[model samples]
Structures are given as C-alpha cells and as structure tokens.
Target: MEIRQLRHFVAVVTEGSFTAAARAELIVQSALSTSVRNLERELGAELFDRTGRRVVLTEAGRALLPQARQLLAGAEAARQAVAQVSGLGAGRLAIGTIQTLTCVDLAGELAAFHREFPAVQVSVREAPVEELIDGLRAGELDLAFLAPDARRLPDGLAPFATWQEDLVLVTAPGHPLAAAGRTLIRDLAAEPFIDFKAGTGLETAVRRLAAHCGLERRITCDVTQIGLLVDLVRAGIGVAIVPRRIGEAAGLPCVRIRQPEPGRSIVLAGRAPRPRNPAAGALLDQLDRLDRFDRLDQLDRLD
Candidate 1:
C-alpha cells in the first residue's frame, strides 16, 4: 500500500469517519474514501464496518490499527533522522495545555523553543484539564501542561515539573464583597458562584476544597472558557475561585480565603517510559529548570 493511502486510512480510523478525516487532512472526501478503499483492497479485508451514521472497526481493523500507527510513527522518525543527519531538526510535535496556565509566560518559552529549533513544527491544542489528559492518552498529543487536581492520574503518566499559585476568590471591582479580606468558605456558601464546569482542573480543585471544608458551593452558572468566566464575574453575575495569575491579569479584586485550601499547581506531564523524540526530551529538560518563571520575580515565582 502507498504511504499516502496508509496515512488516509489511519486518519479515517482515528477520526471514525471519512468526512471528518477528510476535513482534517485537508482533502476531498472522495479522495479520502478512494484511498481507504484502495488500502482495504490491498489488505484483502474490510477495515471498517459501515453502519448508519457510525463507523465501527472490524476485527481485522482492530488487529491492524496498532501496526498502522506504529508504521506511521516509524516513518515520521525516519524522516526526522534524515533531517538530523542533514544538520537540522524536523518533526511535528503536538502539545496540549489546560486553560488555566495559558496566561503564564507560555508564549515566551514557546518562542524560545521555536527560535532554537526552527525546523520543528509545533501544534498546540487547549482543552480542559480532563480532556487534555484524555487526548494525551489517545496519542492525539505529544505533551501537555496541566493543572493538578484531586483526580487520579492516568496510568503511565507522571508529573515532570510543577509551579504553584494560590487560589483566589474574586469579584468585580464594583461588587459589594470585592473588598472583603480573608474570606471564609462558609461565608460564600450561600452566594451565587460562577464555577468552571465539571472535568476542568479548577472545577475539580474547587470540589475537593469544598469537600474538605464540609461545605457545598452554590454554583449559579458554569462556564467552560476561562476568559468568559472572568467576564461573567466582572459583570457581577457571581464570584469565582481561580488562580491568582488569571485574577490579577484580569484586574479583578481578589482575596485569599481564610484557612484556605492549598494552592494549585501547573504540571508538565507525559507518559512515563514512552519513547520520546529528542526535541521533546530537550524541551522537557528546559521546563524542569523552571527558568521560564525565574524572571517573573521571586514573589510571583513558585519554588
């Protein structure tokens, strides 16, 4: 089978639909269909069972799926090897980030990485903490920056590095409670809370902290986007608990909770013992140095 055909077949397998795969691969659906059809003909097996509005991998497809992915991975590594021999770096590295730490000096670090490894192509995807971890497990991402919560981590994944920031209760400048100092969980239990939705790192942390304090929060609204949550709080919809970085950057009034829950942390995590690309390994080393936060000032930087 042609490498192009295998690529199309793998895309279809991963996406579970020819149409979606075609859109992602930037090709016409007809072309993607023909390629998969040709691949099936070559393999003498029906890879996917066609059912109404759903594509299910047949037994044959299941058996071949891992091999297909391995083949693609090997081909990519070979390409990178050739580029390395030719005195340049070349590979596509997919990265994921949680919404919480995006406001940190992430851009500066990325720019430095790109400057040093210009030949490496980087693609970044941002999702909620749970979804980001899910994507990493599904091989959709090479690396991820995540905020730690109370949830159990996936098997084979380990936190490589961490940065800490206190959780802050925030409201708009005009809100009556904006000036409150050392707020208590019990005090805010009855007030409307603008909360992050389920499965996010912030949401998980909030749930854990509430449980520890023996309090049940009254969540009046749930928002998925961090920026939108800040706006909602600014509009006086409700108060929110968020990382101090986001609250400060938004210029919102923030107070540390009395007997507050422990601060949150950003972690660099990935599958342990997985074969990592050289460039990826290097980036991880740089991240571990915590040099990115070093220049931000000692008071703001976590140890």
Candidate 2:
C-alpha cells in the first residue's frame, strides 16, 4: 500500500473518525476515505467497523495497528535522517511535556531552535506524563520532558538529561502557613489545598505525600493550568504543592516540607532506540550546553 494511504488509515484510527482524521491530516474527507478504501482493498480486509458512532478497529485492523505504526515511524525516521544531512532543512519535531515543567525556559528554547533551524516545523504539547509515555512508545513524540512519579520509567524509552527537584508548599502572602518556616506534611491536613487534576505529576506527588503522611487533604480546587494554580494561591484560595523551583519562581511564600520531604524526578527522555527527529538530538545538545542538566552519561541514571 502507498505510504499516504497508510497514513490516512492510521490517522482515522487514532482520531476515531474519518472527519476528524481528514481535518487533522489537512485533506478532504472524501480523499482520506478513498485512500483508506484503497489500502483496505489491497489488504483484502475491512480495517474499521464503520457501523458505530465512533469508528473502531475491526479484527484485521487491530492486527495491523502495531506493524503499521512501526512502518510509518521507520519511514518518517528515514526521511528525517535524510533531511538532517541538509542541516535540518525539512521534517517535523514533536515534543511533549507536563504543564509543571520548570527546569528549562521551554518557550525560549523553542524560539531559539526555530531561529536556528528555520525550515523545520516544530510542535510542543503539554500533557500528563502517562499520555506522553504513550506518545513516545508509539513513536508519535520525538522527545518529552516528564516528571515521572514512579522511579522506574516505562519500557521502550531511554532517559537523557535529568533533574531532581524538591517539593514545597506555596502559600499566599500573610497566609498562616507562610510564616511557619518549614511545615510538616501532617500539618497541611486541615488546610485548604489547590491541586492539579488527576494523573499529572504534581497532582500525583501531592496525593502520594498526603497518603504517606496518613492524612487526607482539604482540597478546595482542582486546577488544570500552572499559572492559574499559582494565581489561585495568590488570591488566597488555597495552597499548592509544587517543585521548589516553580514555587520559588511564583514569587510567593514557598515553605519546605519536613518529616519525610516530598519530591519528584524530572527527566528528558525519548524512544529507547533513539528518536526519529534529528532536531530532538540537536535540542537536547543545546540544553546540555546551557548547563541545566546533570548529565545522564555521568550519572548513568535511567527512569
């Protein structure tokens, strides 16, 4: 089957509908359908069960999914390999990270990378570490900056640069907790808490810390954005648990956690065999030069 046909098929499967897939692929729905039809004809199998409201893979489609993804990823990798020989004049880079990423000036890094490699199309997504892991394993992401709650990273990924961060509680000015010096985790049980949604690194850490301290927190709000979370704290809605660096950057009162401190690991990682986009490597090398990371090579740490 043609690579374009396979791409259309895969897009439809991932997006869950031909309409959405066509929109994502920037092609007419009819054209995308025609391509998938041709692919199915060549394979002599019905790839999708079109009877449902949300399109789903049929048995044959399920069988082809992994191999199809691998083939597509390999093809893209080869194309990028060739493009980089011309100094990254073409090809795309897809990087993912969590909203809590504070170790690097991500926006500034992207802007600089854009100026240096003008022709390369770049996209960055802020998502939960779990979804980022899925993207990495599926080869949809070139690289990711993740704060994994778990110590051991999932398979099919390799760690590069990593930063270990301490967790601290941030409070509004004049809040009772602000002047407490270092607060114990158990002391936060009665306080109003602002937290991120479930599955995020920050939210997960807060949950784990609370659990370890054998106390249930009084959560007042579950926010999705870091800026808004900090703003809520600034408005005295509640306090939040975040990495020490982010808490400090918020310009609010940051209190350390004592009696078994809370912490998480921030790591730059990619697909284990290596990433497809050469731009990912270039960006990592630039980050290395910036002296922001504890070299993975030196520590030989993964996860």
Candidate 3:
C-alpha cells in the first residue's frame, strides 16, 4: 500500500474516528475514508471495523500498526540524514594538509570548530602533495590545504583560499650555515643536507629550486616528515630547506635563500565552493581568515 494510505490508516486509528483523522490531516472525511478503504483492499484485509459513532481496529490492523509506524519513522530518519549530509545539521569532514604547516595553527582551529559544531566530526590526515591530491580525488579527504605546484588538479577540484610563505634554510644551532646569518645556495653544496623524503611538499619545493640552480644538494638523509627532519637537523645530521614558520618553531637557525625567491603559495582546494556543506564552508572561512592574517603579519615583519 502507498505510504499516504498507511498514514491515513494510522491517523484514523489514533483519532478513533475518520472525521477527526481527516480534520487532523487537513483532508475531507470522505477522502480519508476512501484512502483507508483502498489500503484495506490492497492488503486484502479490513483495517478497521466501524461501530456507528466510533471505529475499532481489526485484528490485522492491530498487527500492522507497529510496522507502519516503523516505516514512517525510518522514512523521516532517512530524510533528516540526507539533509544533514547536505550541510543542514551534522556530518563528517575529512581534511588533508602537509606536515610542515606550522603557521596554519590547525590544532587550535580544529578544537574551536569542534566546540562550535559539536555534531560535526572532523578528521585530519597529513600527507605530501601527491598523496593529498590522490586522497582528494579518491574521496578520502573532503578538503585540503596544499602547497602550490602540487601538480595540476583534476577539473572537479576548486581552489578557494591562497597565501604565500617564505622558505628558509635550516640547520642545527652550531651548524656551519647557522653561523652564517644568510646562507647562499652554493655554500650548501658541501654540507650534508637533511631532505624531505619523496611524496612531501617540502621535498618537491627543494627539488624544484635545486633543478633551477643546477645544484645537486648533498642529501644525507631523506625523511618523509618535517618533524623528523627537524629532529635530525637538531642533532646535527644535516641542513635542510623548509617553510620559515617550521624552522622558527623548531627553534633552528635559518638562512634565507637569495636566489629563486624561496617561497611557496598555499591554497585550500576542494569540490565546488557553492555546493559545500556548512561544515566545509566554515572551514573555508577560517582558512581564508588565517591566510589574510598571515599575509598581514608577514608584511608587518617586512616593514
């Protein structure tokens, strides 16, 4: 039977009279009576037995009432779930970012978002540019903060926020480069360098700059994570290049590379901006604000 017929049957059973059910449903009593009759005909059983002024449930109707209620409840639940997924109430958000995003301060921001949208579940995965892009396309990540030159994204991807950050040369406190306030690219040819391993944004940036300078960096260790690289650098393993914020946070000495303009643009990319869920939109807004503040802070430092 149709869901509407089942609902009409339920209303009649609840209000104990066809006229009252129709009044409650905003339908004519005759229409409600016909709907229930049609439903009974489809089921090959009478749902109610009328006794002049009142209607009592048939044995079949008594057995079917719980099932009908369950079906209507489930339908409503499905509707609400779809609405939540469409960004109305609560949903899950997966975010991807590089390991060296020290300036972004995602930790505090995530905590705040969690507090604000307690119903929205947020998860972050750290990966290199290549892997993040792969995850984004593969539907593993809902949003991503990726460094520029992260390969051309697929047509489906859309960029919403952008910012520039300076890259710097980093080494342990007493390393040779640390002593030299600002180190040159050529001067680093002899020093054993700690490099970001394959599949990392910093590694790509370092490789690109090396190719432009036509210099083979003396990489003694290749690690995937910037945190590990920093630990190694702190132990005097070798020198490395990374975002200035990371080096500064690691408390390592950094020298700005003069050639090749050592800086990279950061961008927030995902599916279409117009169709993003409320959680995703909230995240996008926070990221844009963060980027703007970072730019202003950088300008103030320069001045």
Which candidate leads the pack in lDDT? Answer: 2
Best-first order by TM-score: 2, 1, 3
> What tens-digit string does per-residue lDDT give for candidate 3 at 1-303?
788888798778656688878986789999998998898999999888876566888899999988887775455445446756665466667788988776567888898778767777676777778778766664446678887464444567766655677999888898766777686677677888888877666677788888888878877898876679889989988888899988888899988787666876676677653324456767666656755443221211222
Error of 1 at 193 (Å): 1.5
Name the candidate, 1 or 3, with the larger TM-score value. 1
Of the pair 1 and 2, which is ahead by lDDT? Answer: 2
**Candidate number of the best TM-score:** 2
Which of 1 and 3 is the better model by lDDT?
1
Cα RMSD of all models vs. native, in order, equals 4.9, 3.3, 18.3
TM-score on alpha carbons, each prediction? 0.78, 0.82, 0.65
Report how far off residue 300 is in candidate 2 (Å). Answer: 5.7
Q: Model 3, residue 101: what's the lDDT?
A: 75
Candidate 2 residue pairs that clash:
none
Stretches of candidate 2 off by over 4 Å are 12-55, 172-174, 179-181, 220-223, 231-237, 244-252, 273-276, 298-303
| Number of backbone collisions per candidate | 0, 0, 0
Tell me model 1's lDDT, rounded to 2 decimals.
0.75
Q: What is the lDDT of residue 215 in candidate 3?
A: 79
